[model samples]
Target: MKLKLNAISKSFGPVKANSNINLTVDNGEILGLLGENGAGKTTLMNILTGLYKPDSGTILIDNQLKEFQNPREANKSGVGMVHQHFMLVPVFSVTENIILGTEPTTRFNKIDLKTATDKVVKISSEYKLDVDPNALIEKLPVGIQQRVEIIKILLRNAEILIFDEPTAVLTPQEVTEFFEIIKSLKKTGKAIIFITHKLHEVLEICDRINVLRRGKIVGEAFPTKTNNKKLAELMVGRTVKLRTSRRKMEKGKELLKVNNLSILSDKKEPILTNIDLVLHQNEILGIAGVQGNGQTEFIEALTGLRKASTGKIVYFGKECINITPRKIHALGIRHIPEDRQKQGLIGDFSLIENIILNTYYEKDFSNNLKLNWLNAKKEARRIINQYDVRTNSEDISANKLSGGNQQKLLIGREMSRSINLLIASQPTRGVDVGSIEYIHSQIIKARNKGIGVILNSTELEEIIALSDRIIVFYEGKIIAEFPSNSDPKIIGLAMAGVK
Candidate 1:
């Protein structure tokens, strides 16, 4: 299969997401698309998958020009996409989800369950995908769920595959396994477009790479022809120091301490148990774990968003449980919540309003019950500039911006407060490469200024990069701890509870 995108251009309102981008993928090749956050990688891929029609472009499949009006049309034309987020039904079995919409049928239009299951099993074994046909998707791990998504594409007989940030949520071992599977697909003569921000993976797996910056293809290189430093420079269009610059710190006393933290669900089942942790001023403590492994419970308990049945949360030598969220906020604890849209920002509120959301009572932005719009706008603009938030109007509603921009706004809003302790969970998730660097630097800067930082993220690179010390959370317990220079493999094993 050969895919060619010629002069592809797409725009959303004033933003030119893809500006005359031209690229090609030959048969049995993995062409990597590298870009900073807000680059046109996702936009271009969306056009290829028929999610968005390019304002102007031509797509050629096997030297024949084609037009895709919808995803079904793209699928029928032998194109398929596996998104960063899987699209499997939770309650349905793998076979059921795969055969949906185009079930195997007889003359009477009756479903053929046995044939579907048999095909799924055969395809799984052939590609080494190893998914169980009868297993429910909700019961599978993140990696297995990803495989099911891939299997869905295979079942459609997709010759061209587009993988968007595929390894963002996998363990180190699972990533290795996935790479092998991708290689197998390549050997089977499938054209693959691999989209990711990780420079090292581009070097490891991709055959050739194209760099996109601000809606244009800036550079192209083969893996063997370039190094990470050069690729990073190309992606950002500047020399980027990959490591954080932090000043040596004289450690202060513990500002936040959690001992024997335990949480029981509404049904009286234990969600978290026997968790002990501490955060000291001038130290960045990273908690590394897979998602849904009690990280949410631990952070929610400390931030006063959720109640824990049994736990001792001491903040600045005072117990924090049973305290209201307002009281917790008043105590100088800033939380950059995990789910930004749900917990961090009010979607209907203007940027100015969201900026002063928790601190509106201050005399600078408000007096008594009245909000000074001028002062609020001034604050919002300051945050926008300081945080490099890309927005044309401060009066625009919070929901209008992209995901990365939304994250930037939340981080800026939270970090502006006079904070003694900061709880940042998945702080840079889904953010672009440049914003990711900025966020990491800010976290380190806060630590340098003697603020106790509790960083929790699923990204192992982030965990290893920004942490002064790291702890692994598994099954609601602190399963392992390591110092700054710990090996990645060691920490990875601990993430899976392998002591």
Candidate 2:
């Protein structure tokens, strides 16, 4: 199948999400869609998959101009998209999920479960997806769940598959497996569109790369013709500093101490067990692990979001185990939560409102319970300009910003306030390369200024680059500890619970 998007444009009020876009994906070729967050990548894909109608464009599938009213219509036309967030029902079996929208029915109008399972099995085997037909999505690992998504697309007989940040949640090992699957799909002559923030992955997997900046196609490159630095520059329109300058500094007072910390899940299973760590001013303590191996719980405990069942959290010589999150923040502790959508920013609040979330009650932002909207906007403008938030107005809702820019807003709001300690989780999870570089530099600058930091990230390279010391977590326990200069292979082994 050959998919062509010609002169696509979309707008919401004054925000032009996509503008005059032209793209093509040929059969048996992987077209890499490179863009920063909110760079209209999602909007363009939505248009192609029939989620949103393009304001001024024509979609040509195999040179036939067609208008699709909905995703099912696009599916019938052989277009399918695997979203960044999985759309599977947690309780449903893999077979159920794959056959959800377009089920095979008998004359009696009943779902033919056996036929669905058989088709799923055939596709799984053909693509080496390694998915069990009867496996529940809730019980499957993230990587396996992604395979289920692929199987779903394949079952729909989609000739053109769109993957949006498909590997964002997968571990390094699972990434290799996914690459193999992409290779198999290419061999099957499928036209694939891979959307991701990871530059190296694009260079590794793509046949051709197109860069988008501010909703316009700015540049195109082949893997052999372009490098990470060039792609990053194209994406952000600037020379990016790819490395963080984390310099050695004099160790100051002990900032925090977690002794024998333990947490139990709702199932009464230990999620974090006997974790011990120390953070000192002027240092970054990076906690590295595969997702769900107690890193979330540990961060929650430290931030006062969750209580530790059996342990002590000592901060500046005072016990802070059961303190309220607000109290912790009052004590100069700031947190950049892992889930930005749910915890970091309120979707309905304006950019100015969200920027002053922590300090709205202060004299500058408010006076005797009345908000000073003018002052709030000024502060918002300052942060946006300083942090390079890609929004034109402070009145715009934080929800309107791109994922990367939302992160930047949060970092700006959090770091600008007076802080004694910073606990950042997945600091650059969905951000682009340029934003990642800037955020890393900010963290390093914080550490250099004698503020203690606790960094939790699934990316090992990030941990190695920013951490002065590193600890690996597995099965709710600290399996290994190493200096930042330690071999990554040993760290990888520790992350997999192979002590």
Candidate 3:
């Protein structure tokens, strides 16, 4: 199968998301799509998948023009997308979920789930996916759940597959396995488009690379001929710094300490058990783990977003156990939450409003009677200028900004305040390389200024690059600790719950 998108142009009001973009993918080819946030990669993909219509464009499959009215139509034409976040239902079995919309019916018009399960098993075996047809999604590992998604598309006879950040949540071992799966798919004569923010993965897996900058196809390069620096430069349209530069410094006095911290879920089951750790001024305490191994719960407990069943949280010599989030903020503790859109900002709120979302009650922005709009707008503008949060006006809604810009705004708001400690979780998860560089520099800058930082991320490389010390979280416990320069293999094993 061969797919082609020609003269694709899309506009949302004044923003030109894609302008005359042209691309192609053939059978047995894996094409990597590289772009910065807001560079129209998503828009272009949406057009191809029938989620959106381009203002001007043509889609050709096997040299024949095709127009799809919806995602189902696109799927029928052999185009399928495996989203960054899996679209499977947690309570449903793999076969049930796969055959949801297109279930075969028996003579009595009842759903022929038995037939679907058999087909799923066959597809799984053919692709080496190794998924269980009867297994519930919630019981499966993330990597296995991903296989179910692949099996779903293959069962529909999809010839072209789009994987969006497929490895973002996978552990190191799972990533290796995923790469092998991609290679197998390529060998089976499937045209693949792999979109990811990780430059190294693209260079390793892609046959050819096309970079998008400001809604335009800037350049194309083969993985064998180009490097990360060149690709990053092309995506951002500038000379980009791929790594942060930091000077060595001694770790200062203890700024925050956790003692036997334990958190319980709503059902009274333990989520974090007897967690003890320390953070010192002028240091970045990196937390490494897979997505759900108590990292998010631990961060929530620290930020006072979740209650701890037992333990002490000491901040600057004050025992702040069970403190309110406001009190935590008052103690000069800042948090950049994991899910930016949900916890960091209010989508309908203006940029100026979001800048003061947590600080609106402060004296500078409020006087107990009315909000100081002038002061709030001034602070918002300052953050926009300082953080390079690309937006036209402070009056625009927070959701109007791109993912990277939204993150920068959140960081600027938190760091701008008088803070002693910063708790940043997944700080650069979905950001582009240029923004990652900037955010990393900011974290190191905070550390250099004698501020303690608890850096929690799923990206091991980020943790290794910026941390002074590292701790591995596994099934609600800190299994191991290591110096910043410790071997990643050992840490990775610890993350997978190895002793």
Candidate 4:
């Protein structure tokens, strides 16, 4: 099988997402699509997957021109995409999620669960996916859930597979396993398009790499002939610093202290159990853990977004447990939430509005009755310029910006204020290498300025790089703690609940 996108161009209003983009992937090969955020990689993939119609282009499969009006048509033509975010229903079983849209029916016109389970089991075995057909998605690990996604497209008989940031959430061990899976898929004569912002990943696994910049294909390179620095420059059209430089700073006064923090769900089940930690000024305390291991609940409890059953959260010697979010904000504690679109920014609101989202009631931006639009817009423009949020105008809706830009905007909003403590959860998640560098620098800057930072991220490399001290969370408890220079292998084991 072969997939070809020729002269593909797409635009939304004034923003040209893709411009005269040309690309191809052949069977038994993995083509890496590399780009910074908002560089039109997603637009090009959306066009290929029939999510968006190209203003001008021809999609050719096996030398025959084909136009896909919908995703179903694209899937029928052996084209399918596994989105960055999983589309599985949390409550659904693995087989149910795989056969959700295309269910087999009995002669009586009823869903055939037995047939679907058998097919899912067969695919899982054949691809070495090792997924349980009866397992619920919520109960399964992220790596296994990814396999379920792959199995979903395989059941459609897809010859062309597009994986968008597939390894973004995977552990280092899982990433190695995922690469083996990709190699196996290639061996089976599947055309794979691997889209990611990780430079080292493309160099490790891709047969050929194509770099996108400003909605155009700037360059292409083979893995052997290229390196991270070259590829990052190609993606961002600049010399990108792949690592952050941190200066040694002594830990200062205590900014936050948590003692016996325990949170319970509405059903009275413990979400966070007996958590105790402290954050000192001029320090970045990195919280390392696998996803769903009480990190989210702990951050929420600290930010006043979630109520704890029992705890004493002392901020600057004041007990602030169960305080309102606004009161927390008053204490100069800023938070960059995990989910950017859902928690960080209001999609429908303008960038200017999102800039002052939490601070709109402040004396500078408001007079307690009406918003001071002039000052708010000025601050919005300042953040846009300072944070490098790529948008044409501050009047545009927050949704108009890409994922990375949205993140920068959120970071800018949180950091622009007078904050002593910054609770940045997944600060650079889904951001490109260029933006990651900037965000890391900003975080280090905050730490250097005597601001306490609680950095919670699933990415271990990030934790190792920026953190002065590290703590591991496992099953709702701090299982272990380590210094900045601790070996990552030991930390990884600690994250897996090994002390």
Q: Which candidate has the top score in TM-score?
A: 4
Off by over 4 Å in 2: 91-96, 103-118, 133-136, 358-368
TM-scores for candidates 1 onward, in order: 0.88, 0.92, 0.90, 0.93
lDDT of 2 by residue, 1-499 (tens): 9989999999877889899999999999999999887798878998899999999989999999979899999999999899876788999999999999789998899999999999999999998888999989998988999999999988888999999888877878899999999999999899999999999999999999999988999988999999999999999889988776666777789999999999998889889889898899999999998887889889999998997899899999999997899889988999999878778999799999899897888788888778998999899999999888888788988877876788899989988878999999988887888888888898999898999999999899999999999998898999999987678889988888898
Instruction: Tell me how candidate 3 scores on lDDT.
Output: 0.90
Residues 176-232, candidate 3, lDDT per residue (tens digit)?
Answer: 989999899999899999988899999999999999988999999999999998899
- What candidate 4 gets wrong by more than 4 Å, as runs, is 134-140, 265-271
Give the distance in Å from residue 120's predicted Cα in candidate 4 to where it truly belongs.
2.4
- Which residue pairs overlap in candidate 3's backbone? none
Q: Encode model 1's per-residue lDDT on 1-499: one tens digit a residue.
A: 8999999999878888899999999989999999876687877888998889999999999999989998888999999999855678899999999998889987788899899999999999999999999999988987888998898999999999999988766756678899999999999999999987778898999999999988999999999999989998999888887776666677788898888889988899888998988889899898998777799888898888999888799988888876888898888889999778769999899999999989998888778888898989998999998887877779889876655678899999889868888899888866766777788888888888889888988878788888888999888788999998689889888888898
Residue 188 of model 1 has an lDDT of 96
Alpha-carbon lDDT of model 2: 0.90
Residues 1-499, candidate 4: write the lDDT tens digits: 9988899999988888999988999999999999888888877888998999999989999999999999999999999899876789989999999999889999999999999999999998998999999999988988999999999999999999999889877767788999999999999999999988888999999999999988999999999999999999998888988878888899999999999999998899999999999999999999998888899899999999999999799999999999999999999999999988779999899999999999898899999899999999999999999988887899999977877788899999999879999999988877999989988999999899999999999889899999999999999999999999789999999988888
Ranking under TM-score, best-scoring first? Answer: 4, 2, 3, 1
Highest lDDT, which number?
4
lDDT of each: 0.87, 0.90, 0.90, 0.92
3 or 4, greater by TM-score: 4
